[model samples]
Target: MKEKLLTKEDLAEDHKKAVRGNTKTTREDWLAEAQRVLIEEGVDRVKVDRLANKLNVTRGGFYWFFKNRQDLLDILLANWKDSKNDPLTHTLKGKNKTPLDPLVRFIFTTIRERSYSPALDSAMRDWARTSNKTRRAVDLVDNRRISVLAKVYQGLGYEEEEAFIRARIQYFHQVGYYAMGVHESHEQRLHYLPIYFKQLTGFDLPKEALQGFMEE
Candidate 1:
């Protein structure tokens, strides 16, 4: 997943189709499953026949929703980026969140949840190195999200560059933690998430940062 190889026109068109679901199929649900596959399995693993089998639907059923595998991926990335990010935006708008602390929570909470697939994370890391188109898309997606994050951080007094750099480092931190998280239990891994996140960004990540969210 991670915004691997795709064209802008292709992404826009696919985004439209997913957003405009008709009665012939449940476009959102199908796209949700596709996103799960991409996030959990990698962009290349979004096989039409396999998805068809997994959904207990026919290949024809999938075709009704997507023109092909590429189309499915385009929609999946668009939707995931759109949906998974709403909560972060909400936190940004609310007065309750602390400077940079919400950002750390967004990063480490994803690690705690295993939101992205290990298989897919590896694929995209390699893909970004070799595929020009994919690297560009990755850059766009990464920068686009970071830019929004930068805005939030700047409001808290970080200069623009500082905010972006913080977002970038924290982004990589979440990805790295996800790739290596299998070694620990959920509670154990989450225990150090706040401090580890702060270290990545060279920021004053709040001590007892997550105290309110945890139960004794």
Candidate 2:
């Protein structure tokens, strides 16, 4: 007998079976996929079935890690609020650093490394429009971030109220920069860094501040 050729349906069924048999999928795997979906599409599209399809695993695997879809969503929101993983928080925690190091590192991480994802931030903000709980979470995160930025200004000798206002200006400017969907190349943004620094901080960006970034 001639060897039988598998049809497309057969191949798909085989794939389903293979995924169903998979036991290696972890909670982090599911969350990562959900986060990607949340950023690329929207929160509404972050369904369990949809994520299982993207991850090439059975939906059963998801239940092993989460109680339900809401559980996953709650975890996602919690992860966003976790300051230990936040780049801005991490940058501010540096020891024996210059007064301006936090600001410089904040700019570098946000622009160069993209550790603070604008797309993810925009997605969470969009989600906030529909969910009051998410709105509160976003508000909390925003306030915390702004407070950290304010301290950077305070370290530079600005008074409390002035530091708060300046921090809002700097933080809101970056948030709006992404929200407005402004397109600028890395080099173009880099070229404007000193000007933006001066405008936001009321002090010229020192040449040495651009030290490590320029060589990269």
Candidate 3:
């Protein structure tokens, strides 16, 4: 007997169901899984087959969204780069805010609360040790992030040299904290936060704001 062949419509339906079924394997899902694997098990574990197995889907689903593993890596690098220009930038550059307001908001929203990925941060920095492309991407993000923080300091009326120094201090401290794997308890850190803020910004974080942070 002649075998039945699937038409274009039938194949399209299968594709749709493949995406919407238990797997829901889309481009973002692949990238997110790659990031998770990169963070948890280093970049070596972020393979297409590994992610396909993790997602309970076929490697063909990966190719449906990515040309290859390198393509996924490129997307991951782009995401890390874009993270530098996050909502904190808008808070820093907004109107009607005190100089300290921007500083406090940037610290509370970005660093303390961790608006970006520390695991991916460490992973990318580690990846940078070998790959020139990864190094350049990491450097670009670092420069832009520090530049924004410096501008916030400059807006606070600090001299150019002072602003730059303060920016590096704030930015590098968080990087080092994650890079070195510091183990301070959250409550202890919160208790010391006002002191750190005073030194970092040369002023106190208001009682009300500190209270609000604890509430969060």
What TM-score against the true fold does each predicted structure earn?
A: 0.63, 0.88, 0.85
Once model 1 is optimally superposed onto the true structure by TM-score, how far is the C-alpha of residue 18 displaced, in angstroms? 19
After TM-score superposition, the amount by which residue 214's alpha carbon in candidate 1 deviates from its true location, in angstroms, is 1.0
- Kindly indicate the candidate among 1 and 3 with the higher TM-score: 3
Quick one: best TM-score, which candidate? 2
- Candidate 3, superposed: residue stretches over 4 Å from native: 1-23, 83-91, 94-96, 110-114
**Best first by lDDT, ranked:** 2, 3, 1
Cα lDDT tens digits, model 3, 31-84, are: 888988998988877887688678776566666676678888988888777754
- RMSD values for the candidates in order, in angstroms, are 8.3, 7.6, 5.7
Write one digit per residue (lDDT tens) for candidate 2, span 1-216.
222345556545644453534456678889999999999999999998789788887566666677778899999999997887677778766773578888887877788756777788899999999999999999998999999889889989999999999999999998999899899998899899999999998887778878778887
What TM-score does model 1 achieve against the real structure?
A: 0.63
lDDT tens per residue, model 1, 98-122: 6665565565445544443445545
Candidate number of the best lDDT: 2
lDDT of 2: 0.83
Query: How far does residue 98 in candidate 3 sit from its true spot (Å)?
Result: 1.3
